[model samples]
Target chain A: MNDSVIHIEGLHKSYETSAGLFPVLKEVSLHITRGEFVAVMGPSGSGKSTFMNILGCLDHPSAGSYRLDGHDVATLDKDALALLRNRTIGFVFQGFNLLPRMSLQDNVALPLIYCGVERAERHQRARELLVKVGLEKYFDSMPNKISGGQQQRVAIARALINRPSLILADEPTGNLDSHTSTEIMALFESLNREGITIVLVTHELDVAQHAQRQVHFLDGRIVNDHATLHTEASL
Target chain B: MKLAMLGEAWRAMGANRMRTFLTMLGMVIGVGAVVLMMSVGQGAQYSIKQTISAMGSNLFVLLSGSSSTGGVRSGSGGSYTLNVADAEAIAELPGVQAIAPIHPGSAQIVYGPNNWNTSIIGTTPGYLDARSWPVASGNTFTDSDVRSATRVALIGKTAAQNLFGDADPVGQTIRIRQSPFVILGLLSTKGQGMDGRDQDDTIIIPLTTAQRQVFGSQFPGSVRMVMVQTTTQEIMPSVEKSMTELLRQRHRIREGLDDDFSLRNLTAVADSAAEATRVMSLLLGAIASVSLLVGGIGIMNIMLVSVTERTREIGIRMAIGARQRDILLQFLLEAIIISVIGCFIGLLLGIGGALLVELLTGTKVIIALSSVIVAFGVAATVGIFFGYYPARKAAQLDPIEALRYQ
Candidate 1:
């Protein structure tokens, strides 16, 4: 428990619709240890996306105690939660949410701006990350001027700019082709080997195979949790 | 961090240059009109003050009674009911500082070949002291000159310019009404009178010289009008009352009979004129401020649209850990930048417009630095006041819902 990066017990979330209180997640509990890659699998209405939002600290659980990197997320105020998110978690979305008006370099340096980094150091770090992601030539290019794969690379670079302890991705390759998706998964695999914990949501079996462990959700409840057979066999 | 956010804001505003300029147009016109109107109004007030000061302070003009000849009555100052003796008596009163008895007329003035028609003021040496006027060159005519009824005169600037050109008029002789009078000194210029008359286009000579030698007064020692200066403004009413009573006694006027002279408070009339100009200046500024209000509203309107259009960008920043204050400051800075920049351009335009007005219409326009600072300060405040609501709305957006916005 002390080494765990995320620890949730009896997490429950609900929405108040016109029909009344509609529960999305019910009595679900999970834990993710450091340096581990976990994939969450579920259908569209199985509460997996809500679970991802909670883990990212973007939304509050209706009735649950959530601990992220040993901080009680439910107990923290808005500003404290923002600071925690800045320091501990990085998010990559399916839409590659890069601000369109900013250059690729500025988009990658966005998180560092929140961290109060100086402009020179921000540029230096962003340059290094862009070089690492094979986007060394597109530093000043606007986001719309770049391809989808290159834009996703910039988003990943932004997620890593703050040196977060955990990376949370929601269907990161949902809009990418198969070849591009494989290349992005390879980047994630390499990042995991570097000892950064990663949690991802995906319905594709092939994408789930990239993670060491898989958790399946059904009807807002966890139905299975186990190591991937490929990983087990390799071990 | 703030500098970085400002850069981001600049880029965001640059993204829609047309909309930004259109929004700033309102501020541009607002500040421009305010500055121009303030300058013109202040210029008018300034000129009025100059005229009042040139006329002298705490002054009164005592006009002789109108003359009735066969049921056709002439206006006030038509008869010789006021005299030098009455002026001397008024000078003995408590608040009387100085007195000058005047017999004024207009005649053709000739110096060599140059001739001009100008008004003439025949008064004692006390007239200079009462008007607070100084000689620009040479000495003033002495009391002995008045006693001797000498034909020595002081030439005003416009009279000197017309007769002497650039040459000094002192020691020169000018002919007034075909009589030679030596120019003893030059009176300093007093640009214009309250009645739009050229005050500097006149000449002053001794009262005894005019009454005895020039105009030939029907009643010896009597004058048409008397100019009285009071020690302070507060004692004017008492002095006026005393002068009236003393004059009536001297003239042997019966009870319930009208006085032979009437007094006019020049200071009160000038004060009212100044007050009217002040009110006009305020009204002009008030009318211009309406446009400023509209400009602020325009900024608010555009900011609301920008906030709605960039909802997803706000969510992206929030997801990367931007606080509410960060988002608020960003949008607020954009609004302020627009207004301040627009104000700068408007300041230049206003000053240029004032100069153009002065050049074309020959009207005075005073562009005071304090007014410029006030306009700039008000514009910045309007930007902040109107920008707050939209910025707060952007800051309070839910990151989850904002991210999902199309």
Candidate 2:
């Protein structure tokens, strides 16, 4: 049996707004295998973001069973969910979300620090990841000192520091120009070829096209899922 | 895990150097002030008590009035006359070690070309022993002087200093209010009292001479007041009761009439003063403690701002695999560190400030180690107590939403 990284059945998430019980995710069921590069696309309020949150273990399903790495999400308490998130998932944000006060190396080492890695070992792992992201020369540079594209590269390096099973990127290139967006997407594709599973959430078609599988979402449910032809060799 | 979290917290705090320092300043001042104030207050009280106790055991003053707490008071008539015979009568009572009737008056002392102002106290031979007055030179007034109403007098150090100037005052003859009197003795110096009055600015003469020759009053054989000493502190009440009964019988008070002469216990008075001072110091400490609370609130305010400002950083950490407790603990630890450091600085500054006050003012300041401990403990408690809410807020944040924060 191919090991499934995440399995969600009939996931329902409803938010209490002034309009009352507005459903963000309605009867959403999906399964993602380990080592798959999947992209989710949708307009605003399409529940794609909600799905990403659930997949990253940052939130629990409202009324559904979410089993991540074969462990049930509902069984986890607040702290246990946090531990699962820390141990199994890594995240990158659209705005890069690099802490401006921290050096590139520190930013990359942050996840490993949360994972309770020793100082020297955490530093070594962060350095290796930074080198992989072509940020070896900029290890000591602060987030603000680097270009938008380079900051995103640092963020990606941070996401890989814990060697997480799944890498979650939400609007990873939302703030970057087209050229930088292509570069960051290419970095994601290269990371995918190394056998790390990726679940990317974005509204942009060009950014979504870089993944092997693309799922479109509308009104809190998946509308269509299509296979995309892209690999590290093509990039 | 603990060390790593601590390191992360330190790094985060060090990142905002100015904010951390400013936040710590409040705790520093508060703790310092509390420690310093308590020490100084305790010192003042201790010194005062020491001065009182040095006056001797169970020394009391009996004055004629409705109420007189101390020797100095206003708006009262001297109704009871404590005469030499009354003094002798009190001396005969059990537990009464010594009794001296004092006749206080002012006079001018003239020796050679030097003349000086001085208070003249006329009493029996036991007067010196009662008041803890030690003779420095010449002999004190003998019982013969009391009977003969002799013109010989014992001069205090201040009187000797003023009238005789470096010359030996024992053999000198000084004119007291133009009446020539031989200085038979020179008394040793006793420092200033709690009332800031000089204890060594007087001349002692025989009680009979002061009553007959100086004042020229005869009826009832009136005297100023009597100083009484008990054999021991435990027998004071019985001594007081017998003396009161004797005086009352002499005065012929009706069945329920209050005694005309009022008795004052020096030990009780000293104890009361100490209690008052203790209460005053406590009040001062309480007022100063408000600053510590304010400091805690200040820490909370800054922590709130810090949590909000670091929302994205919190998200990033959470995404990286940080437990909610880790994030919470990080912020909480930072707040605690700030408070603890503030307390330490406050303690140092407090002690320094107290010393400075003492140096400048010549006031006794006691630095109690307990105060230092209290300051530090208060600071630490403030940190933990006030830092909880913000830490919880930071911990409960959604990673996805926090990451989306621009």
Candidate 3:
């Protein structure tokens, strides 16, 4: 779509292994528009993680181009790309990746620290986001002191701290129980309803069902890109 | 980045409290050792100067230059170019307060069954005035003692103690070289000199008595050295100049030739000795700096381990939009903070160590603020130098690789 916030064209990635050259992604092009909730699903060894890495600006594509928020990701320098990522994108890992030494509020306020936000204002926003995620009581608690579900919720609060338009959650509920997973999926649905674009990676079809659009990856290429029949009301 | 970044470093350092404390201990001991070494050395130098200048700071000795026999030159002080006549001339010069023509002789002093080997200095009454010494309990020698060439003598406190025990040596007869000499008085105690020699282990007698009685054959007007006392310390140079001119005129030495006599200032000797001590202090300071270097290496070692241990954390920060420079600064700042804290603790420990040294050794150790400032400046520089590798290692990590680290 012309309103695409993330536009990928002829994207490719490779690794120079000791065994020689190894190609991971081949001619994988995808577009993610604003305010869209999308799921990227694939089996293990299918280069799904590699694709996610490139999309997060944590890795560079060997060839071809990828654009995020209308900025050319391939041409931007490391610092400029970092600035773009800081302003426009947030990440959620399967491990919940909350800094264990920090309090929940501080973990949530971490992204804002890079943004040069004042201390009081960062804490204020972190508190507000925590309350929104039903983690108001755990604001001062450390991540390891809380449950897996609470940690993931805190991570989501962290992702939203900088008010980024796009969120990339890689298996957000991968380590959570089935019940906690559904609760997290429900939270993602609510965030999606609030018009924030989210692109998540999951192996479970049940988790992928929560997104409005599902893109299936096989052998490093997209095999299926279609809208999901399930709605937020169903979840 | 933000001031918030500094909080992260503080918290990170705080999280490893035991390790932090151990690391800081190295710096503390290093700096303490350096400061203590320098201060104690300085104190020793100060005391040495004081002791060297104790007798008479402006005292000047006119020593005869070396004499040549055929070709081999005898070292200075072995020659007898300086005589009583030169001393008499130097005494008449302006700014000359007192002059003592001293001739040194060694004798076995025997008081009843007690016998002791001591130096016998034959000088006039002006010697006591030049030395600023007063008789502690008895009278000094008179000018007639030198004129009549009497065998009467003045004993030093140490000699009196050794020969007469506790009994008063004054008015008692002490036999020297088998000749009975009455002890006129006991000289005051002057303690040990700069060269660690007992200043009071001697006796004073008339130059005429030493030449006629002790020497048995030496010339009547011969002197080993002449001690010239100036009226004021500031006029010492003028007195020395006049004395040199008078001696040269008396010796009939030609121009463009070395004088047959040389003058040595005790103040100059004291200053050179003090300079040697100052050099020793600087050497000790340099040696102590090795400990600071070792301490810095400890910091680098721990910082590297920290970087490796927190690889995943670094990845998370990068993934969340922390730039490479940010990561670099975070780790670098952490190292700097550790060193800064180490330096602060070290300063206190060093000052305390100096005071403890002074208390234990009875030496006054002075702590210069400039030394503290230099030590802390070195610490900061060391932190930056040693911390760079590990901080760079953290900053150079690929986010993808770091996140994948276990």
Per-prediction interface RMSD in Å: 0.8, 1.7, 1.1
Best candidate according to DockQ = 1
Tell me how each candidate scores on DockQ against the true complex: 0.73, 0.57, 0.57
Better candidate number, 1 or 3, judged by lDDT: 1
Q: Native-vs-model 2 lDDT? A: 0.83
Residue A149 C-alpha lDDT in model 3:
95
Q: Give the alpha carbon lDDT tens digit for every residue of B1-406 in model 1.
A: 9999999889999999999999998898889888998999999999888899899988999999999999989989998898899999989999999999999987888999999998889998888888889899988998899989999999999999999999999999999878899999999988889999998999999999988877788999999999999999999999989989999999899999999888999999999999999999989999998998899999999999999999999998999898888999999999999999988888888888888999999888999998799889989998999998999999999999999999
Better of 1 and 2 by TM-score: 1
In candidate 2, list every pair of residues with a backbone clash. Answer: A86-B321, A94-A171
lDDT per model vs. reference = 0.92, 0.83, 0.88
Give the poorly placed runs of model 1, Cα more than 4 Å off. A232-235, B110-116, B161-167, B233-238, B241-258
Model 1 chain B lDDT-worst window of ten? B209-218
Model 3, B1-406: lDDT tens per residue? 4578889998999899999888777777777777778778878887876676566667898877788999989877667888778888888898989989888878899999999999999889998888788888778889898889999999998999999889888999989999999988888888778788898999999988987888653445777788888998899888878788888889999999999877888777877888998999999999999998998899899999999999999998998999998998998898888888888888888888889989998887888877888888988988899888999999999888999999
A62-131 per-residue lDDT for model 2 (tens digits): 8989888878889888777777777778878877877777788888887777666788998888889889
* Shift of residue A217 alpha carbon in model 3, Å: 1.6
Q: How far off is residue B188 in model 3, in Å?
A: 12
**Model 2 chain A: worst 10 consecutive residues (lDDT sum):** A226-235
**Deviation of model 2 at A164, angstroms:** 1.5
Clashes of each: 0, 2, 0
